[model samples]
Target: MNSVNNTDAAKPAAGLSINKRSRSWWSAPLREVLDLAFPPRCLLCEVIDYSSNSHSGSYCSECAEQLCPLPINRCLCCGAEIGLYSMSENGCTHCRHRNLRFESVTCLGMYEGPIRKAILAAKWSFSAVPIRSLGRLLATERREELQLLKVDRVIPIPQHWRQRVFRHFNPAWIIAEEIASALQVPCDAHLLYRQRQTRAQKRVPVSQRFGNQAEAFSLQDMHVVDGERILLVDDVLTTGATCSEATKLLRQNGARECHVAVLGRVLDSSA
Candidate 1:
């Protein structure tokens, strides 16, 4: 039998290590050059984010401070801001009588100020950057709450084919993907789909919003959702109409539990 050349075998491993170091050595300077050429900007405010501690390269220090996490005084069911003294076991006044299908909700912040502007910019521009940053921020800030839910899958509230074609991107899908990545869960955009094009929830009055989304969504595959704990993602939760309708379908189709994660939660003044 021929003697094996152990030294030759070790040379290849050492060469591989040298190559990796070489690549890493060059990558740092290249990154610095690129960053110098295109300084990072706040994803929301579009201002230079010089702060080294910026959240996910998304917000400037000011914007980050302004976009702080929602206070603990929010309603657990609907994620609406409420006075600390007003919380109850069943739910807050906003969702006490309302028939919300999702088990609970988490939001980065109330929809206003910087958060509102960021969401609006993301929607109008059809840009994924801001929304992606917002999603990552949401995941980072709400990691504990989200992890406690033990969700098996992440799903974005789907858009109608027509609207999707027009928009060129689905904000919900982008947000869902980021959150799913953070949670190490699968993000399935096609498991659920819009059955019909419904009027924009914003266009419809609050009382009519639920009706608008009724029958607007259907499941493409029920087996995937059956007995699975799901985390539904959306850009914003306004009247909770869209999410509610989506959750109802999941629950009806045997989803064991459904939770919601939204970048912003619109505070209902009437509530």
Candidate 2:
């Protein structure tokens, strides 16, 4: 009986030995706690954990260095990649032909490579942290541009109540809220509402997306936005249709001016 008791006592030490040999036992929980407490590394580089409550992952400094931020010389209207320009230039070719409702659209990066992947993953996967990180990045990178616009409010392109019921979250709301907090501007999410459920814009052709969202939005409380320089926000901008439609609604409701901000901007060949 005494021998048996001693043998049982030895088992715990053996288990501890095994745990020490593997190293994973310690790292798994340590990683979890660290991830929870610290900013996670970037997904692209996997070395720098950005804890800004916006970005997460393991990618570190090198990954940030690898990212290709949007060029400053891009056309103000279409966000198209362009060369050095004079201040007097009226508008890009696409803008000249299209007569857009929004005063301008500014984006953080081209909708390709890491920027696009991050936006897609954050949207489809319900990864709020990454979207927030992208939003903060936009705020930091475009501070000068945002200051120039003198935006008064941050209005997220709202999700319809029906879609919100299923998706459990709104990506645009996440972005807008973060930007609003960073910029010290008020976020007026309830000011705009999606009156109808339009099919997901991804499946539709670019030409048709605008019409699809033509009547998708309406002002919920015009007084909130009246006489304000509104900043409309979204995760990605493909055809400018979604933003344009939202702009028209804001204008109709008496917003002083509307400017669009996005994390990713799709490369339109036409521009």
Candidate 3:
């Protein structure tokens, strides 16, 4: 009576292992049946994608081509598209005189065409498909360049709790998670937080954008960021004010380096 029932104790573990194996075995066939029943459609254009490289069945061939990395030259400092002969070593004309806190910026493409439509759809749609697709595409397109940075952590530019409640989802977090998964780094959504509500950067005038973002963010734990190379992610970069403020906070907290990644970069200031 006092002795433990070793054989009985082992039964539970054995049963759990068999259950896991059963689930794994059935998963692929189940997914295949589901796919046949409801063929995958492009998230952006809602067209059935028959191509193999449909980006996990998220985009059709035409939309995929539209979302491919742009061939235009981009400023390393601010991610602005520059003239073929324009200097980009220090900063482009767009950000040369401005105080941009991030070391460098990377983006999938300019904020127009399919990229713009995908981003705009992501905002109002409750479905995670659009944002997740955009995030995965960004990760796939920028894998090599992002890997070179050797990022220690991925952090999304956070939203205020009120905004989060209103929006019901944070696109940045999803994007950061995808990039972090690709980079094999941790995505810490809670590391940085917006401290107060501010006017949308798009709505604010370019001249007042920096002031609008001033003191808008705070960190949860500075110790986690100390000496770490961080990659800050967001859905779009308009004037670079929001990301700059976030990067400034990370650097002030002792982050070794901070890099920015966004799905879209607005080429026109008025956009």
* Model 2 per-residue lDDT at 32: 68
Q: What is the lDDT of residue 187 in candidate 2?
A: 79
Candidate 3, residues 1-271, lDDT tens digits: the string is 0112223445665578787787898887876786778777787778766454343437876787798655578899988888988879899888887888899888988888778888898777887667877888899888988999999999989988888778868899888878987887888998788889999877887888999999999987878889999899999887788899998888898999999999988854547
In candidate 1, stretches whose alpha carbon ends up further than 4 angstroms from where it belongs are 1-19, 50-57, 269-271
Q: Each model's TM-score?
A: 0.87, 0.77, 0.86
Better of 2 and 3 by TM-score: 3
Q: How well is each residue in 40-145 modelled by candidate 2, as lDDT tens digits?
A: 6556545545442223332344545444474667767767556676331466754556556788778877777777676777677655566666666677667878
Report the Cα lDDT for residue 100, model 2: 68
Q: Any idea what lDDT model 1 has?
A: 0.80
Count steric clashes of candidate 1: 0
Candidate 2 residues lying further than 4 Å off, grouped into runs, are 1-40, 48-59, 68-70, 86-89, 269-271
Clashes of each: 0, 17, 0
- For each candidate, the alpha-carbon lDDT, in order, equals 0.80, 0.72, 0.82
State the local distance difference test value for candidate 2.
0.72
Candidate 1 lDDT for residue 25 = 78
Candidate maximizing TM-score:
1
